[model samples]
Target: MGILERLSRLIRANLNDLIRRAEDPEKIIEQALEDMRAALREARMEVAEAMAELRKLEREQQSYAEQAAAWERKAAEALKAEREDLAREALKRKQQAQALAEGFAQQVAQQQALVNQLTTQLKALESKIQESEARKALLIARKKGVEAAETVRRFESKVDAHSAVEAFDEMERRIEAMEDKHKALAELDRNDIEKELERLDANRQVEEDLNRLKRELGLA
Candidate 1:
C-alpha cells in the first residue's frame, strides 16, 4: 500500500529461499534483483518527495512565526499610543498568527518524521539492492558451475570406460590373429620350395648314374 510498507516487504524477502524454490535459480536471482532495483528507485523518489514536503512545511511554519512576531510588535505600539481598541485588535491578530504558526509547526514535525522514515527506508532498500546485486552474480556463477558439473557427470555416466577398454582389446586380438595366419602361410610356401629343390637334385643324380651305366655297356 504505502511506499514504506512496500520497501519493508522487499527488504524482508529471502533471496536464498526464493532461489531454492525456483526451477531456474539464475532467472530467479535476476528477477529478484530487478525487483529490488525497481523498489529502490521508487523508494528514493518517495524519500525525496517526503523531504521536499518537510522543507515546505518548515518554511510555512517560519513564515507564520514571523507574522506572529510582527503582529505582537504592532500590538505593543498600539498600546503605547493608548489606542486600546487597536491594541485589542492587534493582540487578536497576534493570537491568530501564533495559532497558525503552532499548527504549521506541528505539521512540520509530522512531515519531518515522515521524511526521516522515508530516508531510512530508502537507505535500507539501497543497501538491499547492492547486496542482492552482488549475491545475484555469485549465485548465477555458482549455478553455472553446478550445471557444468552436472553435464560432465552425465557424459561420464553415459560413457562406460570398461566397455571402451574391452573394445580395444578385441580389436587388438583380431589383428594379432591375422598376423599369425599370414606367418603360417609364409612358412608353408617356404616348405614347398625346399621340396621342389630336393626333387630336382634327385632326378639329376639318377640321370648321371644311368649314363655311366650306358657308357660301360658301349665298350662291347
Candidate 2:
C-alpha cells in the first residue's frame, strides 16, 4: 500500500479494542505508540521528497518560460532587420519553448497539489501521534494503577480496572471522532471546478502572450 494509506490505517486503528484483546495493555500501548512514531518519520520523508519534486518542476517551468521570452525577443529583433524568414523561424522556436513551458507549468501545478496533500496528511499524522503518545502514557499509568490496587485489595482493584476500561473506551471514541472530522474537511476542500478554471486561465494567458507578440512584430 502507499505510504499515506499505511499511515491512515495506523491512525484509524482501534486502540481500545487492541488493549482489550492484548494480554498486556502496557506493552501493547507502548508498541502501538512506537509504530505511530515510525510511521510519522516515514511520512516526514515522503513529504520532503514531494516538496523537492515540486520545487524541481517549478524550476523547470521557469527555465522554459525564460527561454520562450528570449526566443520572442530574438524573433522581434529578426523582424526589425527585415529578415522575414529568420523571424518566422525564431517565432517557431518561441512557440516550441512556450509549449514546453506550458507543459512544465502544468506538471508544477500537479506536483504542488501533491505536496499540499502530503503536507496536510503529515500534519494530521503528527497530531495523531502526539495524541496517541499522551493516551499511551495515561493508559500505561492506569494499567499500573490497576495492578497495584489488585495487590492492596481485590474490591478496589475491580473498581480501578473498570474505570481504566471506561477511560480507554472514551479515548477511542474521541479518536474516531477526530478522524471523521479530518475526513470531512478534506472532502470539502476538494474542488474540481477550481482546477478546471485554473487550467483555462493558463490557456488564456498563453493566447494573450501570442497575441501580444503578434502585435509587437506588426503582424496583427
- Which regions of candidate 2 deviate over 4 angstroms? 1-3, 10-23, 154-220
| Per-model TM values vs. the true structure | 0.69, 0.63
RMSD of 1: 6.5
lDDT of 2 by residue, 12-104 (tens): 475655766764767666767777888889988988999998889888889989999998999899999999899899989989989999999
Give per-residue lDDT, candidate 1, residue 135: 81
lDDT of 1 by residue, 53-114 (tens): 88898888899899989988998999899998998999899899899999999999998888
Q: For model 2, where is the 10-residue window of minimal lDDT?
A: 11-20
lDDT of 2 at 61: 89
What does the lDDT come to for candidate 2? 0.84
